[model samples]
Target: MQVLVCGGTGCTSSASHQLREALRREIKARGLSSRVRVFKTGCFGFCKLGPLVVVYPGQILYCRVGVPDVREMVERHFAGGKVVERLLYREPATGEKKLRLHDVHFFQAQQRVALRHCGLINPEDVTEYIACGGYFALADVLLHQTPAQVIETVKKSGLRGRGGGGFPTGKKWEMAAAAPGAEKYVVCNADEGDPGAFMDRSILEGDPHSVLEAMAIAGYAIGAAEGYIYVRAEYPIAVERLERAIRQAREQGLLGRRLFNTGFDFDIDLRLGAGAFVCGEETALLRSATGQRGEPRPRPPYPAQCGLWGKPTLLNNVETYANVPAIISRGADWFASMGTENSKGTKVFSLAGKIMNTGLIEVPMGTTLRTIVFNIGGGIPHGRKFKAVQTGGPSGGCIPEAGLDTPVDYDSLRRIGSMMGSGGLIVMDESDCMVDIAKFYLQFSQDESCGQCTPCRVGVKRMTEILERITEGKGEMSDLDELADLAREVKDASLCGLGQTAPNPVLSTLQYFRDEYEAHIRDKRCPAGVCRALLDYVIDEEKCVSCGLCAKNCVARAINGEKKGRPYFIDRQKCLKCGVCAAHCPQEAIYTA
Candidate 1:
């Protein structure tokens, strides 16, 4: 029997390494080493239940496993053939134990494609990748089909780039191939800088070989002999795994020079990025990859026409390339049949913020947001209502409850005033202030702005200042019109996508949650009580028991009350709006008005 342990970064941080070692020691102690094998694999997507462990023969999925639980798991499951019911996942609503991984609600609606081999195979082992038909697409293209035929197949598949901009992948390859240059380059953009997004990082960590194999296929199709993966240095796990996968593929004659003895010569090298959010853009990424400043230039001579030292280059992000092999091996019609007419394939998303199941998920392209949130995500935690889901990272916009039933495709999201930005779906609950949320995203965009352009550097800063004034209860009603007008200007005048999309949050919030903004500006109050400057702390006299904890903990010394007598009153002038008194109140007497 084989035991698979989640070795992804999330599970690894939760002591999955120690658990694996403990399981090994226990199995050896019980003389079951020959029968029971333990292997460290990739992420299982159910990150909330990690460190996850799965035993074969019955596919018993164990959740939140620690080193201490290894012995009981080994002895009960391996020795006595009894299942460990305590470690199995219990359905949140029904409280029924689910022995298999897919039996849980979190995994029910997911249709894994880009993440196909992830969590299933050992990434470091090339044979495992090959066993799953990893490089067969490249081989098939090399032996049977010509470059034109391959490009035609990809075009017919309706495969679009999954890295924010949904550009046609086949059209990109066809352009690179048709460009007037014999020396072309293929680049895999792995600079995943989106907040709360880990889809690319997880794919790289769990299935590094998939990316490598797909890159080789792209190289063959585009007539590119060299490739570079511009990944950020922040992802050390993904970097290390890619390094190992490249070395393994080279050693096995899968990466370097003639593959299947074809005349095509291709190889890939890694270029580490300095964590610049702008580098996610194609032109900016090419600049960084060529050892230049990571800033985007005007794109009339787009990357396809002249890129990377004036040679035609083909670039696609990690998730986009991960789907290439599947499309090539299993006909374009099969992939085309899955999603809507425009977007045909599955899209992987990182579910974060206020959701019960905070993990990785891949649903078909046209799957509604309501299905993703309620069916697969298991809805909001603590019975809180879902306020909105922010898609496409900071550059994307928020979709309110009224838009929850909208299908999540590139065109659908764009039509709703949002874009699919690298697949970051951050769910917000009622506690999240929409105005504050807009401010937070704008602030991130402003800070990460390359500052090479005037519109993004100065315009976004101005928009951010307006948001600051409104949130601080010092804003005028006319500032609302200024904010909207400035957002449009910055979006139109910005040089690159960073500046172009920086105002998305501001514009989208103004469209959907105008009342929240009005409350902050006109009423001088934070409806969600999230903006500290707009909050007025009050002591609930009925609940206050003179516990004195609030008074003792107040650093501002704003609370006034006798130790055992009347309830404490706050001096608004002296209060710093730190919320310390409210946090320390034992009876929950403190509230924000």
Candidate 2:
């Protein structure tokens, strides 16, 4: 019997380390350490109820576990052979206990291919990874199949790169293989700098071996002997796990020298990025790996043709490499059968924002946004209406409620002015202002721009200024037209993918929620009551109880009237429009105009 504790970053922040230590102490104290082993593994995906603890061979899942609950788990579940019913994950609506991870609604629709070994195997244990068919693909590629055959299998799988841009994976490998160089390289872009994106980090923390195995396979396919994983310095846990996995793989003869006795030599080294968002781009990543300033160069020759010290290089994100092993093991047809016609297999999304079930989920490509937001995500929180769902982090666009029924695939999402980016899906409800959302993404892109190209460096900044003016109620009608023109200019003139797709949020929001922008600029009214500068807080005389709550809570001393008698009124000049009076009012008398 084994107990798996969530070792992902999210759970670690919630004191999951203490929980793991407590479980180990409990096992030792009860003298069940021999019979039952406690281990720390990667994310279980159900982050809403983390830190998650799962017991296997029984596959019993317990959610929201803490250090204090460790003794009961050991005493009842491990030693006595019974589940702790109070600790099990309960269905919100039905109020029933969900034993297995699959029984939970959040995981029911998800088909985890990239996240195959994530919650299952202990990432630090090489034996556990090997038992689950880890290194088998690399061995098969090196011994039986030729490099061409391996590339063909990937091409047939229809597996586009999961890193922001949906480039063909096999084509990228083939380009590097065909490039005239005896010394080529494979790079894993683990520099996931997108705000609110934890997909790459989760994969590295949970299934580090999969990446190592896949990188070895990539090296064999692309005629490269050495690979580099360019990870951000911010992801310390992922970096530690990756380093450990690499060392373990080398010791087991799965990485260095003749891997798996196949005489095909391949190994990987780690390259730490200095938390630059532009380093997420292929060319910028190549520059950073070479110990230079991380910036993107113009891509006529692309990374596959000329990359990593002027040698042929193949680059793919953490999630993309995570999918490689499953494709090689199960065959292309098996993987292709899961998703839509163009897009194959499952896509992992870090589901966040105003959704009830904000966690990590891997659903098939054809799964509609409605299914993701309403079913798997448990809809929006606080009984609010769904306004839009933002995909692709800062580089992607927002899909309004009208596009909810649209199937989530590469081509489908692209058609709606959004790309299947690193798979960061942030759900937005009615309370969120669309104009503010566009401004937020624009600000992120503007800040992350490498400042190499004139259009990207200047255009993104100008667009942000325009957005800020509009949000602050200082915008004119011409600002909308100016925004469209600037977005087009930035998209056309940018050097790399970072600047090229930066305009997506502005363009898509304008296309879908133009009325909101008009309302902000023309009428100077924030319909959602989000733009504090444009809104005025006033006391509703009819509903006011003359209680001292509003007056006490007001920082500006705006409310003044007889307490517990007549209705109170707010002085417009003294009111800071902070909404503290509105929030403090028990009778809901305060209104924003």
Candidate 3:
């Protein structure tokens, strides 16, 4: 029996290591060492139910397994060959315990492509990665296929860069291969700095070898002998694993000079980047990797043409590289047949915010937003209606509930004013204010801006000021016109993608939830009761217990109730409308309108 314990950052922080030790001790104490192997692996994607434990040959998955549960699981299941009923995942609606992995709702809609070897193989173990056909893609390219043939295969696979830009992966490889440079470079953009975005980080932690192998393959394809993984310094776990994988690959003859005994002297090195969102851009990343300020440079001399110290460079994000090995091994047609006409294969998403099953999920392109939010994500929590789903990080836009049926492809999302930005899908409930959401993202983009360009630096700052004024109930209707005008100017005049797409959240909110904006401006009322300046708090006299709890907790002395079991009155003038009264109201008397 093989027992895989989740070793990803999420599970690791949640005492997965302790559980692994407990399981090992229990197995050893029972003298079941020969039959059972307890080991640490990467993320299972179902992060909400971590640290995940999977038992095979049955592929039985256990969720939220604590250290105390390990011995019982071993004694009952591993030793007695019986399933632990309480540990099994009980369905939310049916309450039926699911013993198998595929039976769970969370894993059902997911089609693991880039994430295939993630939970199944121990990332630290080169042998485990090999067992799952890890280096075979690189070996196949090295031994049989020519550089041109490899590039053609990737192009034919219809795989796009999973980074913010959905550029054709094959076209990028071809450009770098054809670029006039004797000393070219392959760069893996692992600077995943998007808010609520962990697709790249999880991939790196889960399958470091997959990325290394793909980079080797890319280096072979692009006539480059050198590669660099520009990962963020914040991802210490991912960085540590990549370093280990590189060291192991070198020791085992997978990396370094004359790899695979083929005269091709290809190698890779890690460059730690200070967490800069702009560094996610290829040029900025290249600049940062070379110990320069992480700033986006003007294009035309693209990364493929003049990159990484005036040499040709092939840059692909971590998720994009994660797909390379599979494309090489499975053949292009297998992947091309999966998604829509334009978008081929699966996309990994970090499903977060207001969703019931908050975790990492991978769904094929063309899968409806409804499917992701409802079927796969288990819908919104607390029985609240989903207002909108935000994609593409801070630069990406929000898709309203009306567009829930829209396909999650590059073109489809772009048409709806959103981009598949590193696959961060933050679900918003009805209680969330769209105006506030746009302001938050705009603020983040402005703060993270390298300020190299005026449009992003000054234009976005102006737009943020307008949003702030509106949210604070100090705006006229003309402010909306100015906001739209500024959005267009910023999008057109901005230097790089960060600036160009900075207006996405604002534009999307205006497009979908214009009424919310209007209410703030015209009525001086926040429909979602989020904008404090536009919110009104009142006490429901009939339901008020007057226990003085709300009054006691109120920072503004808004509630006035001298005696218990009597109706408490709210002094609207004194009320900050902080919702402290509503939150502390024992009888739920205080209300916001």
What is the C-alpha local distance difference test score of each model?
0.92, 0.90, 0.92
Per-residue lDDT tens digits for candidate 2, residues 1-593, read 98889989999999999999999888999999888887888998888889998888877889899988988888898888888999998877668998876778888878889998888888888898999998889888888999999999999999999997788898888888999979999999999987778998999999999999899999999889999999999999999999999999888888888776766788899999999899988888999899898899877788888999998899999999999999999999998898888888889899999988888889889899999999999998778899999999888899999999989888999999998889899998888899999999989888888899998999999999999999999999999999999999999989988889999999999999999999999899988889988998888888998887999998888889999788899898888888888888999999998
Pairs clashing in candidate 2? Answer: none
Give the per-residue Cα lDDT of candidate 1 at 588.
89
What is the alpha-carbon lDDT for the whole of candidate 1? 0.92
Q: Where's the lowest-lDDT run of ten residues in candidate 1?
A: 101-110
- Which candidate number has the best TM-score? 1
Any runs in candidate 3 off by more than 4 Å, and if so which?
A: none
Better of 1 and 2 by lDDT: 1
Between prediction 2 and prediction 3, which has the larger lDDT? Answer: 3
* lDDT of model 2 at position 463: 96
Output the number of the lDDT-best candidate. 1
**Candidate 1 lDDT, 1-593, residue by residue in tens:** 99999999999999998999999999999999999999889889999889999889777899999998988998899899999999999978788999887777787788889999888899888899999998889899999999999999999999999999999999999999999878999999999999999999999999998898889888888899999999999898899999999999999888888888989888999999999999999999999999999899998798889999889999999999999999999999999999899999999999999998889999999999999998899899998888999999998999999999999999999998999999999999999999999999999998898999998999999999999999999999899999999999999999999999999998999999999999998889998889999999999999999979998998888899988899889999999999889888889889999
Which tens-of-lDDT digit does each residue in 1-593 have in candidate 3? 99999999999999998989988988999999999999888889888888888899888988889988877898899999998888788877678899899889888888999999888888998999998888999999999999999999999999999997999999999999999869999999999988998999999999999999999999999999999999999999999999999999999999988888899988899999999888888899999999999999999899999999989999999999999999999999999999999999999999999998888999899999999999999898788999999999998998998999999999999998999888999999999999999999999999999999999999999999999999999999999999999999999999999999999999999998999999999999999889998878888888876688888898887777767666878888888777877887778887887
RMSD of each: 1.0, 1.6, 1.3
* TM-score result, candidate 3: 0.98
Error of model 3, residue 191, in angstroms: 0.7
